[model samples]
Target chain A: GESVGLHLPTLSVQEGDNSIINCAYSNSASDYFIWYKQESGKGPQFIIDIRSNMDKRQGQRVTVLLNKTVKHLSLQIAATQPGDSAVYFCAETFPGNQFYFGTGTSLTVIP
Target chain B: EAGVAQSPRYKIIEKRQSVAFWCNPISGHATLYWYQQILGQGPKLLIQFQNNGVVDDSQLPKDRFSAERLKGVDSTLKIQPAKLEDSAVYLCASSLFGRSYNEQFFGPGTRLTVL
Candidate 1:
């Protein structure tokens, strides 16, 4: 079965530094990829999303980069803030509309 | 528009007991989804509903779990004979149309603890 996975389980960064979180997906048929941030005791929140046709998408202070060749995805947060601390998940959607999520990466921003 | 709504923000039950959570999607939304999120993990789709019809429930523990969307308005997810592993947060979300059509809006979620 195809799966989406992350390279790291945890990421720590200073409040003013740039942070990078990596993910890898093995579903070639996936046409869309989305990033979600979940705070403790809350549901996941939509971050940024990228379509197969595009390589990158940028949002408020977050950027999602998708590399189909390596089946890899990355989320870069500019000027990491304390609010950025959360569990990040990457999800891929296939033509069937089913989405498979990665294990997730926990980001900790040091204030 | 109002966001998705869920009830019983928290619950604690023993194994073999029955528990249920309710969700009401955004007004006019046609797609509803139920997901389970364990501690430190991502939300896993348990079932999906398009209007009042079941779209997918392959991942749901059918023998112990059941879900239904009555009148395409509110939905309920019931877990009977709950197990220890059932302790987690149950999240409900809805999209404007369908999974292939729009992004999802999530609810606060119902946290369950099976003791």
Candidate 2:
């Protein structure tokens, strides 16, 4: 079955440094991708999103890079903060507005 | 603007018991979604509603799970004769429209523990 997967299950980063999380999706037909942050005991929060036609999109202190050829996506956060500690998930949208999510990458920001 | 809202933040029930979760999407949002997220994993879409009409439910465990969105505003997800594996966080999300390009706003979620 086609699925989205993360390269690393856990990541630890020093505060004030940059952090990167990677994801690989198997579906070639997917046209939209999103990154979400889920804090403990909370639902996933929308972070950033990129369209297949665009290779990169940037937001406040965050960037999403999409590589259609390899079906790879990456999320980059600058000046990592303790509040950034959480599980991050990458999702691909299929037809009918259905989304498929990867397992997740747990990010821990050390102060 | 107010975000999505869900009720009964936490629930604990023995296997075979029934449980129900509720959600109210953002005002005037025409699309609603329900997802199940187990610990250490990402959320899995269970069902989707477009203005009180079901659009997709292929991933839903029809034998034990059911959902309804009455009046195209509030929705409920029900699980009957639950199993231990059913334990997970039920998340509700909504978007302005049912399109791949629309961003979905999520609720806090309901944590369900089935013993």
Candidate 3:
């Protein structure tokens, strides 16, 4: 079955540095992608999203880069803070309303 | 505005027991979704409802899992004869129009532990 997957399961970065998380998806029919941040004991919070038609999209300190040709997506965060520590997931939506989520990457910002 | 709401932040039940979780989506949102999140993994969609009608439930374990949105406002998910693998956090989310491009607002989630 087609799925979305992350290259790394855990990442540790120093505060004030930049962080990047990578995701690879198999379904080419997917037209929309979203990045979500989930904190401890909380639900996923929307961070940013990019449409297939666009190559990149930016929101605040977060940027989402989409590579349709390679079916790869990346999320970059600048000036990483301790609050940024959490699990991040990348989700893809195809023709149907259903969304497929990646395994997720846990980002830890060390102070 | 209030975010998505769920009840009983945590639950502990033995295997083969029955359990139910409730969710109330954001006001005026027409699309409701239920997802299961196992530790160390992302949330997986269990079922989706569009204004009181089911739009998708392909991943839901129909044999033991059932969900319904009676008035298109609040919903409930039930699991009968729960298995150990069924122990996980259940999250409810909602979007404005049930559109593919719309953003989904999620709740805090209900954590279930099956002994």
Candidate 4:
């Protein structure tokens, strides 16, 4: 069975500090992975995505690292802000566009 | 360009009652998706369509859930005889297919409560 899981269900970080959230996917065939940020009363928004061909990708103060050997993915947020407090989810796509999502990690940025 | 649009920010109904939600994706986007997101959980794909053709509905509970994307534009999802566990936010998203990298644009979801 294919599964993507987060190491932490919840995390707290200071507003000015960097925060890292980790995820592990069981399927080796998952060629594409993405991180999404979802705030309260809204839908999940795309954060960043990395293909298996690359080990790392960066976007606007965010980076996604993929470790195929360990089948792990991580999202790093620089300078966490109060607005960054939201649930983060990792999703993987295989042969098709259909994506499977992980449980999600709720992030709380304390000011 | 407008983002995906969903109606009725919230809905509440009793079990066995019927409900429906509407979604209008960005114009000319060939792919549309509907997802169910429970509290404290990630969104689950309930149905997907590519130009009015069903791409995937494997996880959709067909017995109670049905979705249609007529004319490859706006879409709707209906639940007949709802269940207590059906309480969740329904999200709609769209992506331009055949592009180099397809990134979906999401709309504010519709929260549903079942009694």
Q: Rate the local accuracy (lDDT) of all candidates.
A: 0.91, 0.95, 0.95, 0.92
With candidate 1 superimposed using the best TM-score fit, by how many Å does residue A87's alpha carbon deviate from the native? 0.9
lDDT of 1 at A102: 87
TM-score of chain B of each: 0.98, 0.99, 0.98, 0.96
For model 2 the local lDDT of residue A6 reads 100
Look at candidate 4 and give me any clashing residue pairs: none
After TM-score superposition, the amount by which residue A33's alpha carbon in candidate 3 deviates from its true location, in angstroms, is 0.3
Off by over 4 Å in 1: none
- Screening candidate 2 with a backbone cut-off below 3 angstroms (N, C-alpha, C), the clashing residue pairs are none
Model 4: per-residue Cα lDDT at residue B32: 92
Ranked candidates, highest DockQ first: 3, 2, 4, 1
> In model 3, which regions exceed 4 Å deviation?
none
Q: For each of the candidates, what fraction of the native contacts does it recover? A: 0.48, 0.91, 0.86, 0.66
* DockQ, all candidates in order: 0.62, 0.83, 0.85, 0.64
**Per-residue lDDT of model 3, residues B1-115, tens digit only:** 9999999899999999999999999999999999999998889999999999999899999999999999889999999989999989999999997778899999999999999
lDDT score for residue B43 of model 4:
84
Say which prediction, candidate 1 or candidate 2, comes out ahead on lDDT.
Answer: 2
RMSD for each of the candidates: 1.1, 0.9, 0.8, 1.3
| Residue lDDT tens for model 3, A3-85 | 99999999999999999999999999999999999999999999999999999999999999999999999999999999999
TM-score of each model, in listed order: 0.97, 0.98, 0.98, 0.97
How many clashing pairs in candidate 2?
Answer: 0
